[model samples]
Target: MKIKLRHLAGKVFLSLILISGLSTPISAQNLISNGDFETWEGISTDTGLDKGIPAGWTSQTGDGNLTLYRTGTPHKGNYSVFARNTSGNVSRMFTPTLQPLSAGKMYKLTFYTRGKGTLANITLTENGEKLNGAVATSPSDKNIFASPSMLNKEYNNGKEWEKQEYTFTIQTDGIYKLIFWPKSTAGTDGETSDYFLLDDIELVEFVDETICTLSEIIVKGSTLKEFDPGILTYNITLAKGAAIPKVTATPADTKASVKITAATKIDGTEPERTTTINVTAADGISTREYKIIFEESNEILREGFASEDRPEKFTYPNKTNWIIDANAAQNNGVFFGNNSIRPKGSDFTDDYFTIDNCTSAGILSFYLKNRGDNANAILTVSYQKTSDSNNWIELKTIPDSEIGTSYEKISLPINSGEPVNIKFHIQKTAGLIGYNIDDISLTPFIATKQENEKTGKDIVFANGNTIHLQTSIPTNYTLYNINGQICTTGNVSGEYTLSVDTAGMYIISLQNANGKSVHKIIIP
Candidate 1:
């Protein structure tokens, strides 16, 4: 009964080791003597094991001519084995029992290996979770033995003992299994004439900790302008402390500001405070500063409405880049218009478009239909900055023959503040040319480099000043004052010449059927 009891305890211990080893290969180690490293150490060749080290070890697979020698190796306890692959397409593996690891503790591991393989990957896992895995090099493995220091460096070949080490902290606590596989990759199924050597392995825990730190934040924009009701848009950097629990943005110095109205939102978050607090320094130079609070709410909507019109636009997603006012007659859901509002010879004279300014530098885009006929006839487009009828400027004179007779898109850049107007004058000579204009939207062009910028009121170009205005179709010459009253009109073709003779700040407006644009010019 005493002998039986001892045998039972030994069997139970072996069973526990096997059960744990089967859980995950990465976390399990074959701790038994010679359980891995197929080195036939003390075994003799008469037993069918062909390869034996010069010192005493033996190998049973792949060219049994290789041997395990007592070369005073480190991890292997006093000796190791070396093999050379001259015919290529060769490999070897060893099973070892590893120790357990603790959670949240960093560790360092070291081993020795050498070879010339086109592919190499090392994997290490703790418990059931993977710790680290990475591909070493690409198009590699020229000389497997070049230096003596590479044996322990993890990669590269060497002439002497090499030590490869890795350090990492475990996020989970449990026993881990490690695997080292190196192979010479071929296109389909080629050959490998490389060599690999293995030696002692060591694992140790690390004590130093250096993490949980944050990086500096930055904020910027291209241009800042006031638009529709003084609402500003800025691309702010959501900093580190921003995610802290229960933090909120106050308008005053304590935690909030006072300039924000109750209906206002910061960074698109609905904050408990309603003021334009200096939580952010609003710095316009270099790197601006922003206060991050730990709040359950956000200020800015990730996506929202358009605050201005983009006229320097042509292409778009889904439907064409044309949109119309829902309440407007005709194309209520946004329609397409050819080049000229009216074809060349049709006497259908009503062709016009409008662009509502949302920011200082606005964009207007539309499509033109080339009826496949027309040479020199032109279109007359005009514009005025304010709907009050003052500071009007003739933009361009587009020929009827030039009307959408070809497959193409057109964009016009408006130079003005928010709330400006646009107009188009149609003209043609020979064939019929028309156009389709829609998707007229206005939004602030928030600069990805500048801080939050606000749009300002419409610019006032003084009377008699020369200002450039772009349009979907070109136009003739026209003049207006600050009172929405038409001053002078011209029938010039294609381009407008503005030599107005008045004074004071004013707006030079230009337009086409698609939209309108405005620019501020000073009249001396």
Candidate 2:
């Protein structure tokens, strides 16, 4: 709890407070063996696998344009993978997996990566994608890969290391392989031969049982503004040695904060003090509340989005670099009145696209309408990150699709924290233009999945400035922003009158007896 002190002439107003991340589970095991390409010691292709490559990994370069070799950059150990693609040929690397992951379970793939130029993607494919036992660099059958939603990828993000994570549900009990392919930008040599560095590739099942993956506990002293609680449960914990459970009345998302005071205490003599943990799914006008019981615990926080690692942001980037043309039928955004243009190309495999960053847990949603040929005006959305950006270990060139002139909604999912540079290519412009777009927008949203027996439940709040805290159970707390910048923090619990002197956005982390709870606040 933080104590805000304001000296006014002679009178002094005193208020008190408590103060914490994305916690790595005490027990997290990577399913992929030798995911870090550090074991390439004297490994040769004398038998079957590729020479000089790490064990349990094989690469294939069709038409000899892409090459997968060892890199000095790594997110973990000293060794990593370097992928370079020149011209327009294809190169793919596959993971050795004679066994199948448990089906019906949720799996998360994460890795750290960076790139110099255009990058391809790392995809999850069926067992047959491998030519017999080794993974094929270019799988002939397009049906071998999983759906777009299940793929975790990475992309180039300057020279810095970025982490990406993707969560998906296993469909069937089949062997899954990871294929890495670095793609050339327009297949022009020296124009943009993309090369990427990857290290510490990991895929794990996210399961945290005994805790709801959507609910969080906040004492009346805490402030939950503009929040959404996915699952509802009441955790009745024994606030040992306190009276009234340190609460006056429940001032949840609906109730006002004025009702909470410091006089209240846990039901000291009541033996079992029920510190009413309220869950709120408030939507401004109305709220839905759920009650949960904690027999012998303090606080609990669970989230599917892992917002601490992934942040949310809204921006209107510079429009000068955007390729705008009359043939493309460009227009301003429906909301901001900003300009938007479609891709222009001529051939079947025309590469008319640019690489841009998508940082956070949300969707790159926009208003789009086809303006070119009815059957040929296609949209090929390829991204690198969790789902599409694990900061940068995976990559994908999503299949193309046709969009008509109905002004439809186009949303491309992005990973939290690990933002990927996306490419919107017009596969078949057909000697014409592409899409008429507007409202180039993005929203940081939560993708919380309630998988039974999951681990590491996360809770992240939107950006704000008002300071409020929950839980009398003491632990460490910290306040930062979406950019990983630390602000203010302390270790205490109670009511606090925060003096957000500056108008800036910040995130508050509360790590108490239960777990860690992160809150984002913007000071205006």
Candidate 3:
């Protein structure tokens, strides 16, 4: 009998084992002797029954045409068993008589194999009677144990060793033999020179007592933004000056125990506090951990496009550009909420969102995904201060080599604390499909009082195409054009003047002992 353990909501369901009244001990050793094929006692020949077979192993070839040898190429250790079929008949290798297994005890068989021939099936038999209901598992693919009499599991590892495992329980107390068929039974009537490499075979008693996952975690002071057993880490925002919440974790198994390391205090000194929950299963060997991060939420703006036709804080200067796409999946777009935004037309357009009175530097992050058929469509992200008359500073361009078909998180560093406007410009070149954007967020940098008081008073103005600055102390000044191109830079004290050859809006930045300050001026 094969007992398969299925999981739901991080809880392992052992109903099959409980209903059958079958349990195995936790400690057991490998029952297959000389299973590694490392002990060969005879010389290898072209064909024979007593030829170079590994100790405790035998083979069956219909007309005695299969050749066996010990090879130095092994997945591990020093040697592995290699079998070659010279005739059209199927060949198989057999294990020695296994130690007697209990009637209701579960056993697990595992081995590493690699080769070219079609490894057809594996079977366990006692006195020519096949054992039923064995389950085979492989990491390369899903479980393919369909028949009870024979396990038709084949892995085409092709020169690379792959591990395979099987689990089953015997209905009667008896000694058994395990067989490995190297060639398919039905086909290959005229096939020859087919080969198989086998190594690292093991059989042990299996006990399923390693389920220590939590079903649910609760916080007393605030609600979780989302909860999923598979997601172990979560970020929660607490109101400023609010006390840290009490946390409780519930294990999936009743026999499992949980320990919580709660945060003792929230004094607003640190930006965040981390709490951890550890769960230990009944066996005391299996464990899992979940973490909660409590942070003072200082979000500047967050847009998920839940219901708005367009983002509320966003302004579409082109007026008829992007629209809320409810069916993001149909268009191969990725979204976190109910919807995302995609270009309504395949034309070059610019759109922007503004955040006012931004007093600290921040990180701007969003999700962007390109259409699979997108061709030469470029999306550029840029930012500029609303009060300054300067061109947008380019942050990133999507659809580059780094972007994939699925939504990828794009994070950019915003170095300024000034009130700013962020722009997303899409230049659709040839293809009608463009990029999709969703889950836009901005988080300001936490600053100390000393860092926040860096800006000092300075007189800066522009007359015609010349910029003038009067500083109280020696300072370094840089003048830039509307396109963010540097016009001039120098160190000056008292009165300073810089004459430029262009006629447009400019920005002048001054840095001194007090710190850095930026000013905007127009030269018309």
Over 1-524, each residue of candidate 2 has an lDDT whose tens digit, in order, gives 01123343333322111000121222378777789888874544422323366778776775445555665556667878766555544466668674466666656667766665443445566666434212222223432433332222235465677776654556567777766654453222322224466788877765422222232334333222223456444333321221232332243333222222232334332323333332222222223434323242221111111111111221124322233332213443233122345444443345534344544434444566766355355555555553544434222232224455566655444434655565555454355555654544444433222321154434333225455543445657666544444567777754343556667655555566664444445567
Q: RMSD in Å for candidate 3, one decimal?
A: 17.2
**Stretches of model 3 off by over 4 angstroms after superposition:** 2-28, 39-44, 47-53, 62-67, 70-79, 86-91, 100-108, 124-176, 184-195, 205-212, 215-228, 231-259, 263-275, 278-524
TM-score to true structure, per model: 0.27, 0.34, 0.35
lDDT per residue as tens, model 3, 4-58: 3344444332222211212234556778878898888776454332248788887
Which predicted model would earn the best TM-score?
3
Candidate 1 lDDT, 316-389, residue by residue in tens: 22122223222122221222111112232444334444433222333334444444453344444454566445
Q: Poorest 10 consecutive residues of model 3 by lDDT?
A: 133-142
> Where does model 2 exceed 4 Å of error?
1-27, 41-51, 117-119, 130-154, 185-195, 208-524
Question: Model 3 reaches what TM-score against the true structure?
Answer: 0.35
- Give residue 464's error in model 1 in angstroms: 4.0
